[model samples]
Target: MVAAALNGGGGQAGEALLTLALPKGRLAEEAAAALRAGGLDVPGEEGEQELVRLLPGSAFGRDLRLLWVRPADVPAYVREGAADAGVTGKDALAEEPQGVLERLDLGFGRCRMVVAVRRAEAERWPARLAGEAGGLSVATKYPRLARRYFLERHGLRPRVLELRGSVEVAATVGMAAAIVDLVQTGATLRANGLVAVEEVLPVSARWIVNPVSLRWKRPLLGELERRLAALAAGEVAAR
Candidate 1:
Protein backbone atom coordinates (compact mmCIF):
# COMPACT_ATOMS: atom_id res chain seq x y z
CA MET A 1 0.00 0.00 0.00
CA VAL A 2 2.86 2.36 0.80
CA ALA A 3 4.38 1.87 -2.63
CA ALA A 4 2.19 4.28 -4.58
CA ALA A 5 3.11 7.46 -2.71
CA LEU A 6 6.85 7.08 -3.22
CA ASN A 7 6.67 6.56 -6.95
CA GLY A 8 8.24 8.65 -9.75
CA GLY A 9 11.47 10.58 -9.97
CA GLY A 10 11.71 14.25 -9.12
CA GLY A 11 12.13 16.97 -11.77
CA GLN A 12 15.82 16.18 -12.02
CA ALA A 13 14.90 12.74 -13.39
CA GLY A 14 15.78 9.65 -11.35
CA GLU A 15 15.44 11.80 -8.24
CA ALA A 16 13.19 9.49 -6.20
CA LEU A 17 11.05 11.53 -3.83
CA LEU A 18 9.30 10.34 -0.68
CA THR A 19 6.21 11.21 1.36
CA LEU A 20 6.63 11.29 5.13
CA ALA A 21 3.78 11.03 7.67
CA LEU A 22 4.03 13.39 10.64
CA PRO A 23 1.88 13.83 13.72
CA LYS A 24 0.01 17.10 14.26
CA GLY A 25 0.46 18.48 17.76
CA ARG A 26 3.26 19.68 19.97
CA LEU A 27 5.35 16.97 18.38
CA ALA A 28 5.00 18.52 14.93
CA GLU A 29 7.06 21.60 15.71
CA GLU A 30 9.84 19.54 17.20
CA ALA A 31 9.80 17.16 14.25
CA ALA A 32 10.05 20.02 11.77
CA ALA A 33 12.82 21.69 13.72
CA ALA A 34 14.73 18.43 13.69
CA LEU A 35 14.31 18.17 9.94
CA ARG A 36 15.40 21.77 9.45
CA ALA A 37 18.35 21.32 11.76
CA GLY A 38 19.33 18.30 9.67
CA GLY A 39 19.45 20.86 6.79
CA LEU A 40 16.10 19.95 5.22
CA ASP A 41 14.48 23.35 5.29
CA VAL A 42 10.68 23.06 5.86
CA PRO A 43 9.14 25.91 3.98
CA GLY A 44 6.12 27.66 5.52
CA GLU A 45 2.97 27.58 3.48
CA GLU A 46 -0.55 29.09 3.22
CA GLY A 47 -3.91 28.14 4.82
CA GLU A 48 -2.99 25.78 7.59
CA GLN A 49 -3.46 25.16 11.29
CA GLU A 50 -0.25 24.42 13.13
CA LEU A 51 -1.91 21.01 13.69
CA VAL A 52 -2.41 19.77 10.13
CA ARG A 53 -0.99 20.08 6.61
CA LEU A 54 2.25 18.62 5.32
CA LEU A 55 4.97 20.68 3.74
CA PRO A 56 5.61 19.86 0.11
CA GLY A 57 9.13 19.74 -1.20
CA SER A 58 10.47 23.22 -1.71
CA ALA A 59 11.89 24.46 -5.02
CA PHE A 60 15.09 24.48 -3.04
CA GLY A 61 17.13 21.37 -2.09
CA ARG A 62 14.21 20.15 0.00
CA ASP A 63 12.10 17.67 -1.96
CA LEU A 64 10.35 15.47 0.54
CA ARG A 65 6.56 15.65 1.08
CA LEU A 66 5.12 15.89 4.55
CA LEU A 67 1.55 14.98 5.59
CA TRP A 68 0.63 16.16 9.05
CA VAL A 69 -1.76 13.65 10.64
CA ARG A 70 -3.50 12.97 13.91
CA PRO A 71 -1.54 11.01 16.50
CA ALA A 72 -3.39 7.70 16.08
CA ASP A 73 -3.75 7.98 12.33
CA VAL A 74 -0.03 8.10 11.53
CA PRO A 75 0.24 4.31 11.21
CA ALA A 76 -2.71 4.04 8.87
CA TYR A 77 -1.09 6.75 6.75
CA VAL A 78 2.09 4.71 6.47
CA ARG A 79 0.66 1.18 6.36
CA GLU A 80 -1.86 2.02 3.67
CA GLY A 81 0.85 3.70 1.59
CA ALA A 82 -0.82 7.08 2.00
CA ALA A 83 2.66 8.32 2.82
CA ASP A 84 5.84 6.48 1.97
CA ALA A 85 7.38 7.16 5.33
CA GLY A 86 6.41 8.78 8.64
CA VAL A 87 7.57 10.24 11.95
CA THR A 88 5.60 9.22 15.04
CA GLY A 89 5.91 8.30 18.72
CA LYS A 90 7.06 4.79 19.68
CA ASP A 91 3.71 4.41 21.42
CA ALA A 92 1.94 4.40 18.06
CA LEU A 93 4.20 1.70 16.64
CA ALA A 94 3.61 -0.54 19.63
CA GLU A 95 -0.14 -0.06 19.43
CA GLU A 96 -0.58 -0.86 15.77
CA PRO A 97 -0.82 -4.52 14.81
CA GLN A 98 1.53 -5.02 11.90
CA GLY A 99 5.02 -6.25 11.03
CA VAL A 100 6.13 -2.73 10.07
CA LEU A 101 9.78 -1.73 9.87
CA GLU A 102 11.06 0.79 12.46
CA ARG A 103 14.08 2.90 11.69
CA LEU A 104 15.89 5.86 13.42
CA ASP A 105 15.04 7.51 16.71
CA LEU A 106 14.64 11.29 16.31
CA GLY A 107 15.22 11.45 20.10
CA PHE A 108 13.19 14.59 20.82
CA GLY A 109 9.87 13.05 21.87
CA ARG A 110 11.38 10.74 24.44
CA CYS A 111 8.92 9.00 26.77
CA ARG A 112 7.98 5.64 28.20
CA MET A 113 5.06 3.22 27.72
CA VAL A 114 4.45 1.90 31.17
CA VAL A 115 2.13 -0.22 33.29
CA ALA A 116 0.45 1.48 36.22
CA VAL A 117 -2.21 0.98 38.89
CA ARG A 118 -3.78 3.18 41.54
CA ARG A 119 -1.16 4.18 44.09
CA ALA A 120 -3.16 2.68 46.93
CA GLU A 121 -3.57 -0.58 45.02
CA ALA A 122 0.01 -0.84 43.85
CA GLU A 123 0.76 -3.33 46.62
CA ARG A 124 -1.78 -5.72 45.08
CA TRP A 125 0.79 -6.80 42.53
CA PRO A 126 2.39 -9.94 43.82
CA ALA A 127 6.17 -10.13 43.60
CA ARG A 128 5.62 -13.67 42.40
CA LEU A 129 2.48 -15.17 41.05
CA ALA A 130 1.41 -18.73 41.67
CA GLY A 131 1.24 -19.83 38.06
CA GLU A 132 0.97 -18.67 34.46
CA ALA A 133 -2.67 -19.81 34.24
CA GLY A 134 -3.94 -16.77 36.13
CA GLY A 135 -4.64 -14.00 33.67
CA LEU A 136 -4.15 -10.27 34.22
CA SER A 137 -6.28 -7.51 32.76
CA VAL A 138 -4.57 -4.39 31.43
CA ALA A 139 -5.85 -1.17 29.85
CA THR A 140 -4.13 0.84 27.16
CA LYS A 141 -4.36 2.40 23.80
CA TYR A 142 -1.72 -0.13 22.80
CA PRO A 143 -3.67 -3.29 23.39
CA ARG A 144 -1.62 -5.24 20.89
CA LEU A 145 1.79 -4.47 22.35
CA ALA A 146 0.53 -4.67 25.89
CA ARG A 147 -0.81 -8.19 25.45
CA ARG A 148 2.21 -9.37 23.52
CA TYR A 149 4.68 -8.01 26.02
CA PHE A 150 3.03 -9.76 28.93
CA LEU A 151 2.58 -13.00 27.03
CA GLU A 152 6.13 -13.16 25.74
CA ARG A 153 8.03 -11.80 28.72
CA HIS A 154 5.98 -12.66 31.79
CA GLY A 155 4.49 -15.89 30.43
CA LEU A 156 1.01 -14.70 31.37
CA ARG A 157 -1.97 -13.88 29.24
CA PRO A 158 -3.09 -10.26 29.50
CA ARG A 159 -6.64 -9.15 28.90
CA VAL A 160 -5.95 -5.84 27.24
CA LEU A 161 -8.65 -3.22 26.61
CA GLU A 162 -7.92 -0.01 24.71
CA LEU A 163 -8.40 3.37 26.35
CA ARG A 164 -8.17 6.70 24.58
CA GLY A 165 -8.20 10.39 25.55
CA SER A 166 -9.67 10.09 29.02
CA VAL A 167 -7.32 7.36 30.17
CA GLU A 168 -7.62 8.03 33.87
CA VAL A 169 -11.32 7.35 33.66
CA ALA A 170 -10.52 3.74 32.75
CA ALA A 171 -9.26 3.10 36.24
CA THR A 172 -12.28 4.65 37.93
CA VAL A 173 -14.74 2.87 35.68
CA GLY A 174 -13.23 -0.51 36.61
CA MET A 175 -12.71 -1.27 32.95
CA ALA A 176 -9.16 -2.49 33.53
CA ALA A 177 -6.91 -3.91 36.17
CA ALA A 178 -4.15 -1.53 35.22
CA ILE A 179 -3.07 0.73 32.39
CA VAL A 180 -0.21 0.71 29.92
CA ASP A 181 0.30 4.32 28.90
CA LEU A 182 2.85 6.90 27.83
CA VAL A 183 4.39 8.87 30.67
CA GLN A 184 6.32 12.03 29.90
CA THR A 185 6.31 13.76 33.28
CA GLY A 186 4.67 11.09 35.49
CA ALA A 187 2.51 13.90 36.85
CA THR A 188 -0.61 12.78 35.02
CA LEU A 189 -0.38 9.31 36.50
CA ARG A 190 0.19 10.69 39.98
CA ALA A 191 -2.71 13.11 39.60
CA ASN A 192 -4.89 10.13 38.86
CA GLY A 193 -3.55 8.27 41.88
CA LEU A 194 -1.60 5.84 39.78
CA VAL A 195 1.92 4.58 40.28
CA ALA A 196 4.20 3.05 37.70
CA VAL A 197 4.44 -0.68 38.13
CA GLU A 198 6.86 -1.26 35.30
CA GLU A 199 7.85 0.06 31.93
CA VAL A 200 6.64 -1.95 28.95
CA LEU A 201 8.86 0.04 26.62
CA PRO A 202 10.76 3.27 26.04
CA VAL A 203 9.84 5.44 23.08
CA SER A 204 10.83 8.49 21.10
CA ALA A 205 9.96 10.02 17.74
CA ARG A 206 11.01 7.40 15.18
CA TRP A 207 11.81 7.85 11.52
CA ILE A 208 10.06 5.01 9.73
CA VAL A 209 9.94 4.21 6.07
CA ASN A 210 7.92 1.65 4.23
CA PRO A 211 10.25 -1.32 3.92
CA VAL A 212 10.16 -1.00 0.15
CA SER A 213 10.40 2.81 0.29
CA LEU A 214 13.42 2.58 2.57
CA ARG A 215 15.23 0.99 -0.35
CA TRP A 216 13.63 2.88 -3.26
CA LYS A 217 13.60 6.24 -1.53
CA ARG A 218 16.92 5.75 0.20
CA PRO A 219 18.60 8.62 -1.60
CA LEU A 220 15.75 10.98 -0.81
CA LEU A 221 14.98 10.00 2.77
CA GLY A 222 18.63 9.66 3.57
CA GLU A 223 19.00 13.38 3.07
CA LEU A 224 16.75 14.05 6.08
CA GLU A 225 17.80 10.98 8.05
CA ARG A 226 21.43 11.98 8.09
CA ARG A 227 20.57 15.40 9.49
CA LEU A 228 18.18 14.26 12.22
CA ALA A 229 20.55 11.56 13.47
CA ALA A 230 23.32 14.10 13.91
CA LEU A 231 21.10 16.45 15.93
CA ALA A 232 19.79 13.65 18.17
CA ALA A 233 23.31 12.47 18.97
CA GLY A 234 24.35 15.93 20.16
CA GLU A 235 21.46 16.31 22.65
CA VAL A 236 23.38 14.33 25.27
CA ALA A 237 26.63 16.17 24.70
CA ALA A 238 25.04 19.62 24.96
CA ARG A 239 23.48 18.69 28.29
Candidate 2:
Protein backbone atom coordinates (compact mmCIF):
# COMPACT_ATOMS: atom_id res chain seq x y z
CA MET A 1 0.00 0.00 0.00
CA VAL A 2 2.67 2.51 1.04
CA ALA A 3 4.91 1.48 -1.85
CA ALA A 4 2.14 2.15 -4.35
CA ALA A 5 1.51 5.65 -3.00
CA LEU A 6 5.13 6.67 -3.40
CA ASN A 7 6.08 4.81 -6.58
CA GLY A 8 2.93 5.28 -8.63
CA GLY A 9 2.82 9.06 -8.79
CA GLY A 10 4.62 11.02 -11.52
CA GLY A 11 4.93 14.78 -11.31
CA GLN A 12 4.58 17.09 -14.32
CA ALA A 13 7.46 16.76 -16.77
CA GLY A 14 8.28 20.44 -16.98
CA GLU A 15 7.48 21.43 -13.43
CA ALA A 16 10.20 22.83 -11.27
CA LEU A 17 11.95 20.26 -9.10
CA LEU A 18 11.57 20.57 -5.34
CA THR A 19 14.48 21.45 -3.09
CA LEU A 20 14.65 20.08 0.44
CA ALA A 21 16.97 21.62 2.97
CA LEU A 22 18.11 19.17 5.63
CA PRO A 23 19.99 20.01 8.79
CA LYS A 24 23.50 18.68 9.29
CA GLY A 25 23.38 16.15 12.13
CA ARG A 26 21.22 13.38 13.51
CA LEU A 27 18.02 14.97 12.30
CA ALA A 28 19.33 15.04 8.76
CA GLU A 29 20.08 11.36 8.84
CA GLU A 30 16.71 10.58 10.35
CA ALA A 31 14.90 12.72 7.80
CA ALA A 32 16.73 11.00 5.00
CA ALA A 33 15.83 7.60 6.42
CA ALA A 34 12.18 8.58 6.63
CA LEU A 35 12.15 9.82 3.06
CA ARG A 36 13.85 6.65 1.91
CA ALA A 37 11.32 4.55 3.77
CA GLY A 38 8.65 6.47 1.90
CA GLY A 39 10.28 5.25 -1.35
CA LEU A 40 12.16 8.44 -2.25
CA ASP A 41 15.68 7.98 -3.56
CA VAL A 42 17.53 9.94 -0.87
CA PRO A 43 21.20 9.08 -0.52
CA GLY A 44 21.71 7.26 2.77
CA GLU A 45 25.28 8.27 3.42
CA GLU A 46 25.85 12.01 3.96
CA GLY A 47 29.47 12.91 3.49
CA GLU A 48 30.81 15.59 5.80
CA GLN A 49 32.53 17.36 2.91
CA GLU A 50 29.48 17.64 0.70
CA LEU A 51 26.88 20.34 1.31
CA VAL A 52 24.50 19.53 -1.55
CA ARG A 53 23.37 16.46 -3.47
CA LEU A 54 20.74 15.66 -6.07
CA LEU A 55 18.50 12.59 -6.22
CA PRO A 56 17.44 12.19 -9.81
CA GLY A 57 14.28 10.33 -10.79
CA SER A 58 12.89 10.45 -7.28
CA ALA A 59 9.42 9.27 -6.36
CA PHE A 60 8.13 12.46 -7.94
CA GLY A 61 9.78 11.45 -11.24
CA ARG A 62 11.94 14.58 -11.12
CA ASP A 63 15.21 15.65 -9.64
CA LEU A 64 14.91 16.16 -5.89
CA ARG A 65 17.77 18.17 -4.52
CA LEU A 66 19.07 18.22 -0.96
CA LEU A 67 20.90 21.04 0.74
CA TRP A 68 22.73 20.35 3.98
CA VAL A 69 22.82 23.35 6.29
CA ARG A 70 23.02 24.29 9.92
CA PRO A 71 19.98 23.21 11.87
CA ALA A 72 19.23 26.78 12.91
CA ASP A 73 19.31 27.93 9.29
CA VAL A 74 16.76 25.45 7.95
CA PRO A 75 13.77 27.65 8.68
CA ALA A 76 15.38 30.64 7.07
CA TYR A 77 16.10 28.68 3.91
CA VAL A 78 12.48 27.58 3.68
CA ARG A 79 11.14 31.02 4.55
CA GLU A 80 13.36 32.77 2.02
CA GLY A 81 12.49 30.21 -0.65
CA ALA A 82 16.06 29.07 -1.03
CA ALA A 83 14.49 25.68 -0.49
CA ASP A 84 10.86 24.75 -0.92
CA ALA A 85 10.83 22.60 2.23
CA GLY A 86 13.09 21.72 5.13
CA VAL A 87 13.47 19.84 8.39
CA THR A 88 14.20 21.83 11.53
CA GLY A 89 13.60 21.52 15.22
CA LYS A 90 10.56 23.10 16.82
CA ASP A 91 12.93 25.14 18.98
CA ALA A 92 14.40 26.78 15.87
CA LEU A 93 10.94 27.23 14.42
CA ALA A 94 9.83 29.08 17.55
CA GLU A 95 12.54 31.70 17.11
CA GLU A 96 11.93 32.11 13.39
CA PRO A 97 9.90 34.97 11.95
CA GLN A 98 6.28 34.20 11.09
CA GLY A 99 6.45 33.40 7.37
CA VAL A 100 6.83 29.65 6.86
CA LEU A 101 4.23 26.96 7.45
CA GLU A 102 4.83 24.00 9.81
CA ARG A 103 3.62 21.07 7.78
CA LEU A 104 4.22 18.07 10.06
CA ASP A 105 5.83 16.99 13.29
CA LEU A 106 8.68 14.65 12.36
CA GLY A 107 8.73 13.38 15.98
CA PHE A 108 12.46 12.73 16.33
CA GLY A 109 15.26 14.51 18.17
CA ARG A 110 12.94 15.01 21.12
CA CYS A 111 14.10 17.39 23.79
CA ARG A 112 12.89 20.14 26.08
CA MET A 113 13.81 23.77 26.31
CA VAL A 114 14.16 24.34 30.03
CA VAL A 115 15.21 26.90 32.59
CA ALA A 116 17.78 25.57 35.02
CA VAL A 117 19.47 27.02 38.05
CA ARG A 118 22.25 25.81 40.27
CA ARG A 119 20.88 23.06 42.48
CA ALA A 120 21.58 25.08 45.62
CA GLU A 121 19.70 28.09 44.31
CA ALA A 122 16.70 26.34 42.79
CA GLU A 123 14.27 27.13 45.59
CA ARG A 124 15.18 30.81 45.80
CA TRP A 125 15.14 31.61 42.10
CA PRO A 126 11.75 33.21 41.62
CA ALA A 127 11.86 34.95 44.99
CA ARG A 128 15.39 36.21 44.61
CA LEU A 129 14.77 37.25 41.06
CA ALA A 130 11.62 39.14 42.03
CA GLY A 131 13.34 40.98 44.83
CA GLU A 132 16.46 41.90 42.90
CA ALA A 133 16.77 45.60 42.22
CA GLY A 134 17.48 45.41 38.52
CA GLY A 135 16.10 42.04 37.47
CA LEU A 136 17.05 38.45 37.17
CA SER A 137 20.05 37.83 34.98
CA VAL A 138 19.40 34.86 32.72
CA ALA A 139 21.79 33.24 30.27
CA THR A 140 20.68 31.20 27.32
CA LYS A 141 21.32 30.22 23.75
CA TYR A 142 17.71 31.02 23.05
CA PRO A 143 17.66 34.60 24.28
CA ARG A 144 14.40 35.39 22.54
CA LEU A 145 12.61 32.43 24.07
CA ALA A 146 14.12 33.05 27.48
CA ARG A 147 13.18 36.72 27.47
CA ARG A 148 9.64 36.08 26.34
CA TYR A 149 9.11 33.21 28.77
CA PHE A 150 10.35 35.16 31.74
CA LEU A 151 8.33 38.23 30.86
CA GLU A 152 5.14 36.40 29.99
CA ARG A 153 5.16 33.64 32.57
CA HIS A 154 6.72 35.27 35.61
CA GLY A 155 5.89 38.91 34.86
CA LEU A 156 9.56 39.71 35.40
CA ARG A 157 11.56 41.25 32.64
CA PRO A 158 14.90 39.61 33.04
CA ARG A 159 18.20 40.77 31.67
CA VAL A 160 18.89 38.12 29.08
CA LEU A 161 22.53 37.24 28.38
CA GLU A 162 22.96 35.46 25.13
CA LEU A 163 25.48 32.64 24.89
CA ARG A 164 26.16 30.53 21.85
CA GLY A 165 27.01 27.42 23.85
CA SER A 166 27.69 26.06 27.36
CA VAL A 167 24.60 27.76 28.81
CA GLU A 168 24.41 25.52 31.90
CA VAL A 169 27.80 26.76 33.09
CA ALA A 170 26.38 30.28 33.38
CA ALA A 171 24.61 29.49 36.64
CA THR A 172 27.47 27.56 38.23
CA VAL A 173 29.99 30.21 37.24
CA GLY A 174 27.73 32.96 38.63
CA MET A 175 27.26 34.54 35.24
CA ALA A 176 23.48 34.41 35.45
CA ALA A 177 20.75 33.50 37.91
CA ALA A 178 19.46 30.77 35.59
CA ILE A 179 20.08 29.20 32.24
CA VAL A 180 17.79 28.21 29.43
CA ASP A 181 18.90 25.36 27.15
CA LEU A 182 17.77 22.21 25.48
CA VAL A 183 17.73 19.14 27.74
CA GLN A 184 17.58 15.70 26.18
CA THR A 185 18.65 13.42 29.05
CA GLY A 186 19.46 15.86 31.92
CA ALA A 187 22.96 14.38 32.12
CA THR A 188 24.70 17.60 31.20
CA LEU A 189 22.73 19.58 33.78
CA ARG A 190 23.53 17.03 36.46
CA ALA A 191 27.19 17.06 35.62
CA ASN A 192 27.20 20.83 35.92
CA GLY A 193 25.31 20.86 39.24
CA LEU A 194 22.29 22.50 37.62
CA VAL A 195 18.70 21.41 37.97
CA ALA A 196 15.85 22.19 35.65
CA VAL A 197 13.27 24.45 37.27
CA GLU A 198 11.07 25.30 34.33
CA GLU A 199 10.24 23.70 31.02
CA VAL A 200 9.87 26.31 28.29
CA LEU A 201 9.00 24.10 25.37
CA PRO A 202 9.00 20.50 24.18
CA VAL A 203 10.91 20.31 20.93
CA SER A 204 11.10 17.86 18.05
CA ALA A 205 12.10 17.97 14.40
CA ARG A 206 9.39 19.39 12.14
CA TRP A 207 8.66 19.64 8.43
CA ILE A 208 8.37 23.24 7.31
CA VAL A 209 7.19 24.43 3.91
CA ASN A 210 7.47 27.63 1.98
CA PRO A 211 4.07 29.24 1.47
CA VAL A 212 4.87 30.05 -2.15
CA SER A 213 5.91 26.49 -2.86
CA LEU A 214 2.82 25.09 -1.23
CA ARG A 215 0.66 27.31 -3.35
CA TRP A 216 2.32 26.45 -6.63
CA LYS A 217 3.10 22.78 -5.99
CA ARG A 218 0.23 21.67 -3.84
CA PRO A 219 -0.22 18.30 -5.53
CA LEU A 220 3.42 17.35 -5.36
CA LEU A 221 3.73 18.57 -1.78
CA GLY A 222 0.57 16.74 -0.77
CA GLU A 223 1.87 13.46 -2.12
CA LEU A 224 5.14 13.83 -0.26
CA GLU A 225 3.32 14.72 2.92
CA ARG A 226 1.14 11.63 2.71
CA ARG A 227 4.11 9.30 2.30
CA LEU A 228 6.08 10.94 5.09
CA ALA A 229 3.04 10.84 7.34
CA ALA A 230 2.71 7.13 6.82
CA LEU A 231 6.36 6.59 7.68
CA ALA A 232 6.10 8.70 10.83
CA ALA A 233 2.98 6.84 11.90
CA GLY A 234 4.70 3.51 11.45
CA GLU A 235 7.59 4.64 13.60
CA VAL A 236 5.23 5.75 16.35
CA ALA A 237 3.32 2.51 16.22
CA ALA A 238 6.51 0.48 16.51
CA ARG A 239 7.42 2.30 19.71
Residues 42-140 of candidate 2: C-alpha lDDT, one tens digit per residue: 877544246766556775786776778988898887887767788889988887748899988877788999999999988886677778666689998
lDDT of 2 at 41: 83
- For residues 1-239, what per-residue lDDT tens digits would candidate 1 score against the true structure? 12333343232112344566777875777776776676665643321253333334541354556667876788777776656677788888877837457777777788888888777767766443222144566778787888788887777777777767667668656666678888989999888888888888988888776666666667666766776678878863564
Candidate 2 displacement at residue 73 in angstroms = 0.5
TM-score of candidate 1 on Cα atoms, chains taken together: 0.81
Q: Distance (Å) between predicted and true CA of 107, model 2?
A: 1.1
Least well predicted 10-residue stretch by lDDT in candidate 1 = 5-14
Reference-based lDDT, residue 102, model 2: 96
Top candidate, metric lDDT? 2
Q: Which stretches of candidate 1 lie over 4 Å from their true place?
A: 1-16, 43-63, 97-99, 127-135
